[model samples]
Target chain A: MDGFWIILSGTLIAISCGLLGAYLVLRKMAMVGDAISHAVLPGIVLAYLFSGSRETIPMLIGAAVLGVLTTVLIELFYKQARLQIDASIGITFTWLFAIGIILISVFAGQVDLDQDCVLYGEIAYVPLDLWFTASGINLGPRTVWIAATLLLLILTFIYFGRRGLFITTFNEEYAKALGLNVAFWHYALMGSVSLTTVVSFESVGAILVVAFLIVPPATAYLITTSLKPMLWLTAFFGFLSSLGGYFLAVWINGSIAGAMATVAGIFFLCVWIFSLIKQKQASIPFRA
Target chain B: MNDKTAIEAHNLTVSYNRRPVLWNVDFELPAGQVIGIIGPNGSGKTTLLKAIMDLVKKSSGYVKLFEQDLEEVRERISYVPQRESVDWDFPASVMDVVLMGRYRKNKLLKRLSKADRDLAAEALEKVNMLEYSNRQISQLSGGQQQRVFIARSLAQGADLYIMDEPFVGVDAATEEAIMLLMQEMKKEGKTVVVVHHDLQTAKLYFDWIVLLNTRLVASGPKDQIFNEALLQEAYGGKLNVLSKVGELIKEKDFPVREK
Candidate 1:
């Protein structure tokens, strides 16, 4: 029962991040998602310092604010300073992440937060943090409920904003000319990226969250030709990675999040190699 | 000609970082005509189209579409940006891209109706791309990509169509298809304006021409404006005097160029 619960929580985290990550990968903004996850570290530290607890709500709010700020600063560096996008993202997130690490070390004795936990979280302990009603009505683990709610929210955002997101992602200038309020859609996507990063990172930690955010979508992208199939494939790949990774962790007595990220990478490699072989086979007959 | 003016710009001046790109451009285009905006490289041709669509801010002057503000006539106008401006590798099919044309007609949350889907199909059929509706845009030839863009605008069903460099880097067949589509739209009493680079085809493709070299050299019927002198003025690469004056104006930090 404990193992099942842990894997279930991990799968939910993977699915939400994978779904949102598809759009980020499509838009060539995968690194931006990575940057947000790292930059939100300072937000997490600040929220803990102020609230003196690991409560999800205040931490989420803090992460969201930094996520938006990270995007704005990246844009400024890219546009105002005329730097390359990768450089801007590289500069902004690393600085924020470094600040977070410094803060954690400075208050090491006072806070329960550990630097190792920030890299790959202790999702095995997730079942221990159960939520119950005042009358002692158990409602499963808090991580399960939070991950489920985020999954629902991410799906709703994608469903309602599909058209605008599609148009903008494909051709921003065309969407702008059509009067689709391109900037609003841009910020809305950034907001979703922030929300996904905050919730998923809480369980999976920085490294695994970044892996899930990019690897599954990238794997899905290689095999699928259209957005609908790509989305479905991404979710499927996310589930496979989480399931395989959880068992691998159990077998090796290693980090579950690390195992999940490794599984996602393995899936991407398999698809890439398979696609290349198929392409070569298709060309062989024509050449002959 | 007493036909209604489709686009009117008066004393339009556009600049970037204190350097004027378009200087006091004034022109009027009649409705139901194929108008070509011809200019040399960096003559602000694309910039002009962008300004009219309100995609970019104009340094000065006013542009009215169909005798009204662009905001008031947005639905009546359809703009096709350069095909090279978009990433062809995006994960969207031909049908998905075409369906975007109907986005304005539906609310953000509402799904596109069946009627909208039918209209998108009809638009694709007009461009002979109906068979490729399910294909990914990345698998398309350059010509097919251009045709897809045209099909998207066709689905817009606007009274005026504005395209920027649609003929660049397309196959001969795609060029002919686009030309036929434009003629068909003109027959339907819809205005078509294109920013064209090839001067040879300008005579045959456009009914009217707006010759520009950072300034409105001439704008009129093809027979009148397509002559040798206007061509030289627009593309002779000897607008040194005008550029010199522009430089002086910029150096002086003048609010407006003394034309």
Candidate 2:
């Protein structure tokens, strides 16, 4: 039952990240997600410190606000300050994450969070934090419910905003000419990335969340020729990686988040090899 | 609201980082004619088109499309940006790309209707790209890609077509096909404005030419304004006497004023 709950939680997080990740990959903004996951660290830390509690709601609010701030800061640095994108992302996330680390270390005695857990999440501990009534009706872990709600929210956004996202990602100039608010779609996408990161950060940590946010969609990119297929394939790869990684962790007695990322990486490698072989086969007839 | 004028720009100026690229541009393009925007490198030809399309933030002055504000006439305008502007590796089929033209009419949150799909197909057929409708955009050749873009513009069903360097890097056959499509659009009483690079072919392709070089050098009918003096002014003496004569040779078949 513990294993079942853990895998379910991871899969939920994976699906949420995977759906949003397809758009990120399409827009070539995968690194933006990386930057947001890290930059939201300080916000999370500040929420914990100011509230004097490990409440999920406050931390999520902080992470969302900081996620938007990170995007705004990156834009300001690159557009107004004339910094390169890489430089902008680098400066913003590192400083913010450093502040988070310092705050955690400074208040180590009071804070239940640690730097190690921030890097590689504690999914194993997820089952311990149960949300139930006084009658002892089991409502499952808070992380599971959070991940499920986030996944639903992400899916809803994708369903309603599919055309807007498609047009914006495919061509911004055309989208602009069509009278669509390109900036709104852009920030809305970044908003989804933030929400997914914040909700998944507790289950999979910041670093591995980047993997779930990028790898599945990237793997889907190799196999699919269109956006719809890529999105469906991304969710499939995300679920497969989560389920496979969970069992692999059980067998090897390793970190679940790390093992899940490894599984995603392995899937990417397999797809790459398969594509290369297909290309070679097609070229052989021409050579002959 | 001048019914005869398709586009009118007055005192238009655009700059990048405070350095002016297009300066004091004034011109009026007539409706139902194929117009060419010709200029040398760094002459802000593309900038002028972007300004008219409202794609770039103009430093000064105003532009009117069909004698009204750009925002009001946006749906009536179709823009074919440079081929190199977008990523060809984008995961979308040719049909999908063309269907984007229908997005303006379909609007957000509304699925493209069956009529929209038929219009996309008919647009593709117009460009002879209907057979490759299902193919991914990345698999297309340079010329085929240009055709697909034209097909997309056709799907837009706009009154005015603004294309930037559409003929660049395309095969001669594709060039002819696009020219025929432009002429067909003209027959349908739609106006086309192209940013053309080749001075030799400019004479044959466009009936009206707007010579640009950081400003409006001259804009008028081909016979009225396609003269050596205007060319010299637009090119800024870069084409010396010999090259100027060479241009005469290239344009010899067409009766050009030697002055």
In the predicted model 2, the residue pairs found to clash are: none
Off by over 4 Å in 1: A52-54, A79-82, A98-120, B1-3, B238-259
DockQ of each: 0.54, 0.59
Output the lDDT of residue A100, model 1. Answer: 87
Cα lDDT tens digits, model 2, A27-109, are: 77788878887887788888888897777688878878999999888878987788888898889888888888888888888
Which tens-of-lDDT digit does each residue in B1-259 have in candidate 1?
Answer: 2339999999999987768898999989999999999887789999999989988769999999988988878888999999888888888899999988888834867988999899999999999999999999999987898889988988988999999999877778999989988899999999999999777788889999999888989999999986667777787755456955664556365223311
Model 2 share of native interface contacts: 0.67
Where is model 2 more than 4 Å wrong at Cα? Answer: A101-120, B240-259
**True-vs-predicted CA distance for residue B112, candidate 1, Å:** 1.2
Every candidate's lDDT: 0.86, 0.87
TM-score of 2: 0.93
lDDT of 1 by residue, A1-288 (tens): 777778888888888888888888887789887899888878878888999988768877888889999988987898778789889999999999999889888988877876456434567788898999999999888888988999999898888888878888889888888888888888888888887887777776877778888999999999888998898899899989989998999899898888988999999999999999999999999999
Q: B26-122, model 2: which lDDT tens digit per residue?
A: 9999999999999887899998888888889999999999999989988889999888788889889999999989986346888889999999999
